[model samples]
Target: MSAFNLETCARSNILALEPYRCARDDYKDDGTNILLDANENAYGPSLTTAAASSASSATTSSGPEIDFLGLHRYPDPHQRGLKRLLCNLRNTHHHTDKKITPDNLFVGVGSDEAIDSLMRCFCVPGRDRILVCPPTYGMYSVSAQVNDVGLVKIPLLPAPSFALDVANIKQALSNEPNIKLAYLCSPGNPTGAPLAKEDIRQLLEHPTWNGVVIVDEAYIDFSPEGSSLAEWVAEWPNLAIMQTSSKGFGMAGIRLGSLFASAPIARLLNSMKSPYNITSPTSALAMYAFSPDGLAVMHANREKIVAQRERLIRELPKIKGIGRLRGGIESNFLLYELLNKVGQPDNVTALAVYERLAENRGVVVRFRGKEHGCLGCLRITVGTETEVTRFLESVGETLAEVNGHDIVVYSDEEKREVEANAVIS
Candidate 1:
């Protein structure tokens, strides 16, 4: 096996590029404000105490005082405090012997920024390529297109499991040395299953593939315990993991995404990122999210989501036109087939049901009929108890309206068979 070399992996021009420097780079904001440098509003933010107080309860702060007044000032460019809190959070969650430090972390606008940054940092436009498994996240391909970077697609091993094609990925890596990054979506989007750890390990331990393997763990917290590969970053310098506060922390509005990588890779991303990319409000909310109280709420909410997911598993199949649930039940959403009269996956019926539910009944769910191996599929997120009930009712009504028949509740034996087939298929 060859040693992982950042020099070989990164673009030649990026290695030589000098990052843009701002006034904050010269003098760090340490709260001693005799500030007349950045041309920020000295009068403070144009917000009332009443307005701030009303929204203060949304954060995990002990008191009602939010730092909304400081919005005029530029946020921390380095995000020192937030990174420290994130490091602590991951260390505690993963229980790694080697603790992560601020240097090993990169905070971006969202996972999208990190995703694009990784491409820009390594792949040369039009010359280098990245590998992705289909029936996966779309942003990877979108980012690749936006960056003008080439892409090589290896579709996930057919439906139901959607596991990574590890052998083929390694083969691609070996054959195409220009492929600098491979994006793996665990608890995959559209396909709720996770890639096996040993499968990922095979790619990481490949003798010739020196490019970075990025694991997007956007839904890891929703998965079973010990499912995250974050702790392994300490061991593999070429490994980078993308996590977001959107799914588990319930802070999607914050637009904060994290990248856990070796210190060098983290530092590289930090250098290239726009200064003040993360705003003050986003930082404050994220900090509170990491607080003890915030964590408790997150966990409690997660349990509710998991329970609701189980409810979805049990209830969705009982509906007349809903076929076997595809993919593993590790993420917040489920992907299942929309069956026709003959009980086979049918896209026409799926589209009719999806459109009717949204346009007529005011219930919205994604119609994923076009994605690889996801024929006649609808990706439904597990909502609150009330929301789930509404969805179930709406879906039944929509299916009956589309099919022009009364909804038939499946027998217990039929439901069991469908569920069992979902598990094994």
Candidate 2:
């Protein structure tokens, strides 16, 4: 094991480092007589966010009736029920080599907290460094800066499908003696492709990353199955897998996130986390959703989202000026790389297109500028079918207005042919 400078790693930002010792006076808020202390709603979970019950099917052919509730209480510090449900989904017990129990899991405010915690627990400030591959998630770098840890970015080799450069990553780990974390955001954020399983396995086996390898499966549900490196947690004590209900589970508003790791890492995370992390209502509702029947709803939703995502991919390119749609439909989000005559290999100015999309199309999409390596790309989240239709309509309108060309919506066959030709060329 590389000698980690324990003291430095422990010194996070003031918010993380300060001990929580609230005075009785501090607990008293100066407000009106009818004051609600924390400003949380007297009611719990929003009506739109609630999962349909077993006895009652809301999304049936009859009509669309959304049922939601409001909250009133602290959430469970340890999200016991939701953890079990997720474990069941992953088939944690079915592992032949290693047995994973609930002890191996820890729930956080969100995976953002887990990322911050990993930096706090592992990366020694000043001396130690953590590595991130560019064209990946930005949180890793942001969290490192906040925690005062060093960040080494090795841009993912864009050729041969934007795969991680294992050699460069290993070299960074070897050269940086105190390197503590290697972040892999699979089916990555803007690029939208899953890291090959074999490439991930190599990183786990590599001696340099015996520190901590965080596999952020934020978009895994959208990708092809059996691609997660989650099962490797038991085999590699240094590994941590981050999952979130926000993206796939349609619970992003709940702010629920999970960390799956070996028992030892789980213990440390639990010890460091703030008490009462999850509110009581959140836990109760999540428990309700975790029930075998509620899970069916989630799976059904996933299937619907996947289907709609495929439909979007097939239909997107017929609009003029749109080039290759670079991301995979495995997740709910699709990142399309636009073909701009002005877009250079490494220098596609995405913000100009982004501005055009927002003002001309009335669709809000994330534009990665030069800093993130996406020169002419726009990331669009997959919403409902109606939402998608509206989005495509917007795309067509925007293209027509921007380029003075007639918008030609392609049929399924036409779109596929274009994609195939685009790929071949």
lDDT digits (tens) for residues 118-215 of candidate 1: 99999988888999999889999999999899999999998787999887888899897589999999989989888888888788888887699999
Name the lDDT value of residue 128 in candidate 1: 88
Clashing residue pairs in candidate 1 are none
Instruction: Assess every candidate by TM-score.
Output: 0.93, 0.79
lDDT of 1: 0.85
lDDT of each: 0.85, 0.67
Name the best candidate (by lDDT).
Answer: 1
Candidate 1 differs from the real structure by a C-alpha RMSD in angstroms, to one decimal, of 3.0
**Highest TM-score against the true fold, candidate:** 1
Off by over 4 Å in 2: 1-75, 92-97, 208-210, 341-350, 369-373, 407-417
